[model samples]
Target: MIRIGAVSYLNTKPLICGLRERLSGIGKLSLNLPSRLAQDLAAGRLDVALIPSVEYFRATGYSIVSNAVIGCRGPVWSVRLLSRVPIQQIKRLALDEGSRTSAAMVRVLLSEMHGLSPETIPLAIDQTPETVDADAILVIGDRAMHPEHGVYEEIWDLGDRWCRWTELPFVFAMWVARPGVDTTGLAEILQASRDEGLRSLETIASREAATHGLTNEDLHRYFVENLHFHLGPGERAGLQAFQEKATALGLVDTPKSTL
Candidate 1:
């Protein structure tokens, strides 16, 4: 059986909805944080993974499986930077320890869009923005959706920033596999799973909402409106722009898309 890695975030639920009953006979599912999934896939423990786009640049032999992605065209509720200081006046940022792509995207946005490169420190999982020794802090995943995070006077949603800057959706992650692996029919499998998941979103949202401390309605809206799955023409243009910016900023080595 092919071992595939998927992240356990609320944003990913739609892609994996009804996946077990459907792909169970084909691929083995392994759920973990996005960063860990990236590492395991890179280390050869996984046959394929839904991995951060930046990780594709760091590792070799990763051929992207097209037609699906974790991305946003507008304001993504998660992956935010919170601060009382303005983006220009900020001197330091506490980066999320769990983020690989969002953290890099923050740097890219700051350097390319704002002309600011503040000192950065890793923000611990349990640490609050006020407790961290930085003017601003990047928080991603479910924790970023917390009610308490509203205390921040300035909130910078990275996806919205990217769209406004580049006028294209920002692709956070995509399905990729080792080049030598036999991935025939794999993209079709991934796309089919995504289609099934999208069709059964309400049930998936209801089942997963409470687990993430969000209401069913909230999760449903997040799935249908905030998060985007298709890596079509717009998303591909965005990904290309993002890669160019990341490479130009020296955040990662240049990566060529397989599809």
Candidate 2:
């Protein structure tokens, strides 16, 4: 079996819908957090994995595979900043340790978009986002979509922020495989699965609505409006742009990005 690392999150459900059955003969999938998945891929525990795009730059000998991706044209509801004050006034930023890419993106935005460089603290799984000392909190994944976010004075949608700044979409994750891994025919399966999942989004909404305490309509809209899956030409350009910005900030030491 070809070991594959998959991120366990709602946004990813669409990309992997019916994926196991399709790749049952060639793929053995293991689901984990984005950070762990990246680690597994780097250690050769996985042949391929869907990883935070920033991580693809950390190591060599990998190639991005498939047009399938987790991205947004604008306002991805799940990756956002909840702040008690305007971004410019932020003095301390708490970062959710769940995903490094989102954290780095927020840092880039904080410096380039808002022109503020605050002390950033890593928030543990049990830490509250509304800590007294935190002026802004970068929360990602399903937690960012929670109803409690309404209490924040400012809600900065990072995807929309990226689009506003760059006039391009933002790609959060991509599938990468170790060098020489056979990707032939896999891209078709990956993209096709996303198409199939999107076509049946209502069903997914119905099934997962309660998991996040969202109404079916709310969940359905999230699947339809807040997410974009295809990694087309535009997304590639956005990906390159992101790499350039990330590289510029010294977040990446490689001096160049290949994928």
Show model 1 residue runs off by greater than 4 Å: 147-150, 257-259
| Ten contiguous residues minimizing lDDT sum, candidate 1 | 145-154
Q: Which stretches of candidate 2 lie over 4 Å from their true place?
A: 147-151, 255-259
By how many angstroms RMSD does model 2 differ from the true structure?
1.7
lDDT of 2: 0.85
lDDT of 1 by residue, 1-259 (tens): 8888888888888777666766667878889888889989988899889999888877777888757789999989988988768788879889987779999899998898779989999988777666887888899999888736456668888888989988999989899897677778878878888998899889888998998898999988988888999988898888778777887878877566643
State every prediction's TM-score relative to the real structure: 0.93, 0.94
Clash pairs of candidate 2? none
For model 2, where is the 10-residue window of minimal lDDT?
250-259
